[model samples]
Target: MSAFGAWTTAHGLPAFSYTMDQERDPRAEWDPILEPPTRRHAVHLGNRRITLVADNYGLSGLFDEHTALRWLTRDTGVTRVGELSTDISGSERIFGPTFVIVRVADDQVSLERTVLCPEGEAPWVLIRLRVRNLLGEPARLTLTEEWAARPAQVNLISGTAPSTGPDEDVGLELELIGGARPRRTGSGRLAVPLLLAAHGERVVELRYGLLDDTAPSFEGSLAALRDRLPRASAPRAPEAEREIPWHAALLTGAACADGVLGGHTLDQGSCYSFRHGFNGAARDPLQHALPLVYIEPDLALSVLRNTCAWGSPDGDLPYALGPDKQPWTDLFRPSDQNLWALWLAAEYLSATGEEAAFREPVPYHPLHRAAPVPLGEHLRRQFRFFTDVVGRGEHGHVRMLNADWNDMAITESGVDRELMIAQGESVLNSAMAAWVLPRYAVLAERLGDLVTAAEARKLGEELRGLVAEEWNGRWFRRAYGPGAVVGDSDMWLEVQPWAILCGATPPGRAAELLRRIEATAAAGSPLGARLRWPVREHHGPGGVGTIWYAINMTLIWAAADHVPELGWQWWRRMSLAAHANAYPDVWEGTLSGPDAYLAPETDRPGRTWDLADLGIAMQAYPVANLHSHSQPLLAYLRLLGVEPFSERAGTGDGARFASRALTVGP
Candidate 1:
């Protein structure tokens, strides 16, 4: 049995295991034994990530390490026999629910280890190991941890070593009930040795902390971690209890403090780092907060409040918020940051029926800021920055002075008084305005701010009209700059879907628009949809090209705009694209999540890399990459002729803030 299964069975839970039989081409680098635990085999409790694999390799990631302690020498690190075999006493076993424990037994001994991470704490991982000697003679074992080095310093303190490295800091400390601390056995090698009597058993635990807060006493931190062990190994309830799909539990969990995340893996580490800036990018965290509003309301509120704390008094949300709660404005003035903030607030209010949360006093404000205002006032400040401050382009649409959602869409335009420039009017931004402004109006009206509600409704209508004008029957254009209309040059994929979502498309036209989108944007590939069409050359990763999972998700979301069945079809396609068998011989991802993007549909030889098997495209939140995957639920409800937020809005849907209002769809 796997170590996880062993633990689960030991705890009275039934264990189930399976293996996929497939013929492998000798040239393919992917090893069947090395496939990261299938999603089902992985157990993630809160922010703790524990995955069980079939071999002593533990997890085949950049920072991956097998659990058991081995004998160490000056010349060699850890010894390994190729693959697990059935011969003699040699075999690998897996354990249950989320397979997080693995047991490997040989003629000489049996060893098992369980991995876990605790919630709302330091980014730390814990490994618990149990070993029993099988030979008649006593044996001495040396436990070793190996990962590629990223930073320079390694400190050992009270069995708690906090190491600082580049981009991220990592600390690994070994704790034993009555054992010796790790000693430097050879050049750059650290290990702890223990001798076991014939047929004797031993247990040891290792704790790893990322971004270790050295300020705390080591004993205190160690005790806190120890307190969490029972909860980690306990037979916890499934994520399905929250009404989410089992497969999507990881996405929702990671959005909050309860999820276990692999600490940032550096270039020097063994596994590729899927760094979607934790300290940077206002949009990233907000995207994570989207679905979280539905599942974990308080966590959602915390994310919103913390982000707005870094907002400038002028109403520009910072592109990056530092740990000090300060804003980083010099890198780029993100054009779309404020919109995401507003959307987050609206979604939270809609999902939780909590107007008082908005009315609560603002918890944070940057330096030179005025006395604290209520959250509602902060939101209005952001809207005013949008209306009175950030002016429209020549086409009367929102300007992409710095950059919109597409960071690469930056222009050479210089800055203005607001520290923003007018590069062009983006249809995507304008459509987003049209879609979200009315929602904001709904929110304002709910909060009894009639004047703000009227203003938002008026602006939303005007922007919706402009977006409609940009739709030339076949597809909506991308944007209009100082002298030219983009996407009119060639049908681009960015703006049309948003037009449908925002109700800018005429009632009878949404379905046709979706059909046209499918034909053009997804024309080249069978595996999935491309981000755009007519691949604009020499634009770097830009133009109507490349298969980005983000764009595909948006398109699927658009598909659900009116027709539930259509939306389901696209959703199924997206899910299938992530599967290894979905392709003839290639496995896209080692785990059960979509890759960042597939290779360009045109490249036959390199097409194999498009699947997640390439490793570099591995991401933490693929489901909510560009926009939150929760968007589809809203669309699905609409197709069923039910307004998602209608129940939440209640009878006060007309003008008053009700405790249970829902978004009404036409």
Candidate 2:
């Protein structure tokens, strides 16, 4: 069944939409416009961005502070809006409110505009402006399009100087088409009359682009813009088939000028920083690449190769892998990253029928000695480090040198290097290891390494059993720390779900554990699920009861593990959050995109556009990879006995109900 049909049947209908009508006649239906310089209602097109708030203003870059376009009334030489009433709408084109700006004066010449990010990499924004004669008599309406080059040094190495007086000469240029030519001022401002009509209604197609090598033409640009809308408005794929187009668009947006992937912050055409740089994250790109390998095999292969290519001498993947690497906390090496590499490599082989990748050599250095090893051999070495080296602890789980995914350190000093073994074993990381190792073992056996395969399978089973012991009858304890469980006082929602995904949770106890999660971790908030239930005084960096997309995703995976209906609910909540509603079209609580992590419950519905929110939003796009072929909607479909990819032969029962939509085969 179509995703829309299923959604409507299950949840009535989607509460959000794009069309909002003011007063309509045979002449025109004045759709609400997003006012200028808006915080929440902004549509990004390439580097050019337009915020729909009280005024029709825009800037360049995904989430930049530079004001590239500001609305000005040319007829009266006035800027900004007078008075307004807002009606919000959301669609696949953009997710925000549409607005109608009233002049609030004697003239009362109202301007209605709608902005959208047209599909394509061309650096241009599309805005539809409609001017109406609201008064009894005809009115002369002329709106000015202002373009200015503000002098601001963002991400400058030597630090930015305070704005010297306005006399600090900055070069600016402007080109207007399909409207009256704009006049340029020496102060880096260009004003163009956008709408000039004294009749029933006048519509102007405003296509604006930043300065580039080729001048943008109305015909070429407009054609490109119109072509994208059809695809964006194409029939919604079925539940299990959504990710195909979803990730394609997201990955297209994720492309950097330097040919690398970065986000969870910023959007398409935005500059990359230390946080979301090409070499920034060793694990994030790999994580993104896991499910992505199914569609964009070459792109996913490149990301995996980049991670493996940049490994440290000890086969340790750094926390960040960019040219200008900046680690969030360098105290502990991330053991999970290397494991992720092996898992991805195994997945790559499973997805594609290519075995040349296995024989391909990758550069490595364990003791700073330069040597290249085959890709398969490199992955085996990394898996050994993950298990034999970093996986050491008295608790028989992976040792938390500093932090796992939770990063739940109880002290200001972070995890002590000397006391790491004594502190606790990472149940989350170990559980993941328990899950991925068996898959890796299968790959090894296929590659003629029976010894490694046998050993990995044995260790994987042992680790799975060890992690299962942490199940405290209700939910799994966070970790086995010194003399006690670290988070035994309350549930750390992040780690518990992994046992379900990794096949460590017993069948009899799985249902009860999910119930506990729903009661504690997922309760109280419509912002999906929190990382924990009750807030600890200072739960360290991961913090107490903060909402993270990672945990929310795991919640869906666990829900898919047992109850498909629960998975659908979580997916609906995430969809509602993205569409600016919690339930239906009723706009009440917080309107947030799928962000990296919301602040702890103490902060309530935290800032919407912070920390990789777009990255999280991409996961909901249905095509973007969520690791293990495990998209929430796809998992639900799988639970409903639907096989989207029934062309291939199934591997085993383990492949039957796993989160992965694509099984291990070519």
The candidate that wins on TM-score is: 1
Model 1 off-target regions past 4 Å?
1-56, 59-100, 120-122, 130-172, 177-206, 210-247, 252-280, 321-326, 363-372, 410-423, 536-540, 576-579, 583-595, 599-644, 647-666
TM-scores for all candidates: the values are: 0.67, 0.63
lDDT scores of the candidates, listed in order? 0.47, 0.46
The Cα error of candidate 1 at residue 589, in Å, is 3.8
In model 1, the Cα lDDT at residue 326 comes to 44
lDDT of model 1, residue 62: 16
Q: Summing lDDT over every window of 10 consecutive residues in candidate 2, give the lowest-scoring window.
A: 2-11
Question: Each prediction's Cα RMSD?
Answer: 10.3, 9.9
Residues 341-389, candidate 2: write the lDDT tens digits.
8777777777675778788776652324567777787787777777766
